[model samples]
Target: MATTPDTPVAKALRRELLLVTGMSGAGRSTVGNALEDLGWYVVDNLPPQMLRPLVDLSRHTGDSIPRVAAVVDIRGGRLFADVQAALESLRDTDDTRLLFLDATDAVLVRRFENVRRPHPLQGDGTLLDGISAERARMAELRSQADIVIDTSELNIHQLATLVQEQFAEEDEPTTRVTVLSFGYKYGLPSDADHVADCRFLPNPFWVPELKELTGLDDVVADYVLGLPGAGEFIDGYVAALRPVFDGYGRENKRHATIALGCTGGKHRSVAIAEELGRRLSALPGIAVSVKHRDLGRE
Candidate 1:
């Protein structure tokens, strides 16, 4: 009863496989570095066609490399075009998951400009044009991604932190929750699965004493939480989310983004988001992290 290389039993020997891909400037390197720090065997610029062989190698190595992560991108040219088929080939083998890194076109362009290098697909066209073309090419893969991280507003440290949160350990939680605080004036967070508005609470911006302080400050957090109905909202929201979290767990959804917004994103939203993150973190089998998207934009 020898199982073939492509058989389910053979694939099950490799416990974890992460295929990291996405836009050129969307922090793939950061993800790879973070995964490496977590003791994952990370292979950079791996062609899609090699995915199965990589998994087989990991299985062959036994306990030497329990987790394997491959970084695949447009740099492989036509070889990259085989990703979807490669992914399908690995569907039943191991805990294979795809992590797609993304950022807005403007942000991608800015990143490329900062590095003073043209996009791989840029050719003679502008940076924005290259980004657009890449996006178009990645559209299908993005749609099939198990997790899509938008790094438009995230700094390098923040992006690294996110990667660590998602894949820091082998015994990580089943679901990872990110409580993001943003500003309504800055447009909604594109990756938010659920959004709550803290504008109904008093505006801390008008309070001269707390105007400059962020939600991370004890004084500002106290002021924001002291408002009427603030506590009720937090409690009710957490209670309502109990079933939602259960549903997500049952559906095998590993990530959820809860975005909280206020007028300026400096005070109310940030405070509420922190409180919500605190409460959500207490839920069993859930990993929570908070990000103040527009904390210092003003």
Candidate 2:
């Protein structure tokens, strides 16, 4: 049935379309649930061609289903190619937005292994091969996304919290920066956007009394922050990030990871990461969180 343009249902459904997509193990399912928690009508694995009709269904269903979010990914195989054409119909309007979720290759592989499932496109090849194929195919979609989240270090709860933070309010999405602390021996955090070393500070491990203590302890933190040049580095690094944040804004990147490393994550790096987190949190429109990636590994 053709409905009048002014119908209450049609008017209620005039909001933007939110398309959730990304890597196979990149938490698309979690994001969909997060959207549902935010009161959105979420559809999973929706075929690209049915997108417009889905909207029409909402438009004709009265105000019961005003906002809609769809999770589309590689599971649709060849049909995924039609997504470009499907998106073209919505491009003329400002009502279409895409949210892309991604994680480092290592993280994605780990996720798949943890679930004991093969990659959707893996076939008879190695896990890496399937991941490579999926990334290549999804490249264009990723580039077109309005929001890109790197989930390399996030747990499901954290990811859900982040999704809620971005979509909970209509005002504006807040940029979140994660300051991660790690030990050099453990290798760099694969997802870090910025990295700084705190090894210049003398190791507290040699200072018998502080050996067993971590940066969270007041004494360990005080010792690290009181060292020569510690305060200077923190100030300068925070200052330098201003231009970086500006660049991110221009590029519309809402998430960033900064890694600080030391000989061991137990002391200096952890202390520095906390300081950086505190400083970065004070910045306007930006939220900051700190994590000690290798804190207790020793």
Candidate 3:
């Protein structure tokens, strides 16, 4: 018998399907970016109607996109209803998950203000009015969300870490990890998985000689590590995180991020991030990478 579009083989190839939808100003882009970082094939602002077709085509192409995230938002114009249909279709298919990102109105407003971008519906009326419409339109979809996120309370690092926890290279032993160390002053790095604040640590910036050097430099690293509670903190911190890693390893957790932050992000946060990366990489398995968000800058 000839296989039909609804055949088992056709659905089997669709390894992972993620339907990305959320409020206009919520952290949809952030979620997409974070997933992309985790090795997913991400399509932003995909017309809602194209979702099923895209997934079908991906299957026919030998599943070129094993892990896929398609953004189906209000940008689809009249095709918005297709998002609802596509989501419903995927729910019936095996091996597919739908995630909806969301946040409070105040948080959405702040995000829009920070980005200085008009909401999708802003062209027709007041920004607030547009936001309200967008929210109303998304109400039904939000209710069906398998996972809902409140970005209002989460920092970039925390958000990234959450994404990594959920979707990293499933069976890969080696995955590139991005460790972002940022300062609270320069507005935290917007793409960190896990963020740890190091403001409590001694400040290398206070020392005239090390003030000009970053934590990457031996002088600053030495000064920061010699702090009163540095050793004790690292010990306790690692102890707390060890279980999480063990769980991730046992469960084959793919992507994960941990952020360390401090006042200047130049000294304490940087040092801690570096140390953390080193310790993490030393594990028998897994890969690690580190980036200091405020290292080069003042």
Candidate 4:
């Protein structure tokens, strides 16, 4: 959505405006892509002061652009020094929300190194110094955010998927659940809202015939599910999670991540997570999907 010469800026309150901001190297680009995929009109690197024009354009365009997500960084060639003033200028004009995406300094530095680009705030100092400046500049945005996602543990694809799940418009209010399976040796999934360990069950890697198969295979899945505590654990965990989902829906929080870890992600964790997803999907007003994070890492 953009304001054209014919559109009046005073009548821009008809459109919903979402301002996406955060520390540099966080995941604004990915989040913008996800929102665009879900049918939102996305504008990138837009200065906060330019929001009125965009909203004006959307307002005059009728319902063609019901939603507009603008990626606004404080360092985008212009400093939004007073986050409050920047936000208040538009809040009374439209339904505005600020989304802040963040990660640890270590993660931001690693990302910059991987992309082989200089940080926007980086000048003569080291990468850490640049991250420190960016974090400090973004502190106000975080404080005023309507939503915040810590991307410290999220990969590009994972971040995109989560954004899509979190912002998609549903026919009715519903909760979205992601069941992620990973190997304990690879460390935990820091983005997970809840985590469960599956190491108590016997390892299918010990069975010669099942060693090469993954949990997606019928035999391997059956073998893992047939274990002593598997069914009981799955049943109890699903029961315990139902109330959590309901509570999230009540609070207007739409997305959740539940991680399962075992010795290796190939068998036990994958099978159990898939089963849990299946059960959760069967409930009313809940959508579930599964991801095997370390399934093929061997």
Candidate 5:
């Protein structure tokens, strides 16, 4: 059921052109990977200046692929703005979207540490310093985004699916909800614009028995949620947030992110994220997946 121009909202798949950009550690790879899964011809880390040329090349060849996604970022150096211009040039065509992935500084630090990768902007500075620089550099790109996603709390799998559901939509809602839980020491997640700190919740890491297990484990999940306000908070929080997501599903907002954090990220945040993901998935019109960022470190 490909959506066509005259088929109305119910039947046509407005041809999609997406420019994916964001913080380096903010899950751009994951988003690109998911768009690939959705059948978009994906190109990563392309310079912004080359966007129009690439699109022209694609059109000239008349390739069979109808959907196209490009991952362009600061790594493209001073050319990122060029890419934004190219996307804007196509905005009136009825099938173009610009998605910006983001997260908190803490999550970005932890992700870089876990992966043992150096920050592009750091060059000789500290990881946190590099993240700050990257954020500052991408400010303009963020403002122009048609869809903005905070990937701080999103796991790789969840980030991928979210890209697909949001940008790859035509008929049904296939949005994937990524739940990321990380530590404060690692810095906030580079992709999460909206953050929920659960540091006040009891720390399971201090408990000798639970130290070995991740928040995903049944024991950890139970222990974290067993706290006084934990369950109640999740219920009300979910109730409040549900409408936003549901509206996105109904209106088909392309890309979105919700991040949850805690002191260590291995327990309370992970448990709550997992719980939230479960609840989001049960909804009739939405798609969901869960990930715990800090769990991968261990």
Candidate 6:
């Protein structure tokens, strides 16, 4: 048998092959859209067995499809098991990466309810029942994932921004940070790697004038940041996170979520998160964005 030398198309295929899989309602579509926006050739609901054929076809197309992302899920039923084997085989010849999207059971349930659709695995049982079964089946894959994003607290735009941050052109920063402001009453963000409580600062909600304004307003922002220990806490927290950020770089973690919580997300937490974001953005080699998860929930 004659051995064929590697060609340009084969070299290109070996550079980028991403397998996107996760919870049914965890925003795989959003991820696909974002990846497309960033120049990825996306294939939706592709069965595992078809992956190799797709790559082979892409090779024929040359550089037109430089990067390829395939969205795979449990919807394939029994064939889902083949995904693991396919992934293992690709690892030998490709720079394969698996990205897993996840959210809490509560969030998934709410999303399913909003869409008025039954879980693929629900059968005759409740939504939670299906969620439980799916999670059990996906346990191994999740553990094997190179990147895992928890979308429990993310809105559509926030999730899209995350995908863009992770998949955008190579010139961007290596690590992107999301500084999230959320209300304690609304529950902590499940995806947050670090959380800070802003309750120690005075509640602006009680201040009649500031109550009407959000942290985006200078008056509210000044009030929150002027409190004793406020500036010091932000500075200290940033300093403390320096090593954490360094570690993330060393470990090749591309994204990190830092959540700040107060009684309500409208005032204290939002102000703090903004200031933190501003400060972090100034640091070299890091990109930061701020989001108020419960800003209008009042």
Task: Point out the worst 10-residue segment of candidate 6 by lDDT.
Answer: 1-10
Question: What are the per-residue Cα lDDT tens digits for candidate 4 across 111-131?
Answer: 999999988878998899888
lDDT on C-alpha atoms for all candidate structures: 0.89, 0.87, 0.76, 0.85, 0.75, 0.89
Report the lDDT tens digits of candidate 2 across residue range 136-156: 999999999999999999887
Ranking by TM-score: 3, 6, 1, 2, 4, 5
Best by TM-score: 3
Please name the candidate that would achieve the greatest lDDT relative to the true structure. Answer: 1
* Reference-based lDDT, residue 298, model 4: 78
Error of 2 at 165 (Å): 0.9
Query: Model 6, which residues run further than 4 Å from truth?
Result: 1-14, 171-298
**Which is better, 3 or 4, measured by lDDT?**
4
TM-score of 3: 0.56
Candidate 5 vs candidate 6: the TM-score winner is 6
What is candidate 3's lDDT per residue for 167-221, written digit by digit as tens? 7655544344566788888886666556677888768888898888888898777
Model 1 per-residue lDDT tens digits across residues 130-214 = 8889999999999999999999998876777677667866566657899999999999999999999999998988999988888
Candidate 5 at 202: error in angstroms?
60
- Off by more than 4 A, model 4: 1-14, 172-298
Candidate 5 C-alpha lDDT tens digits along 1-298: 6655566763233445688888888888877776775668898888876766766666655546557787888777677657656767777764677888898998989999999989988888999999998898788878988888998787776676566566654744544455566788778888863577788788898999998787889998999889989988888877877777766544435345667888777788888888887887786656666767776664
Better of 1 and 2 by lDDT: 1
Assess every candidate by TM-score: 0.54, 0.53, 0.56, 0.53, 0.52, 0.54
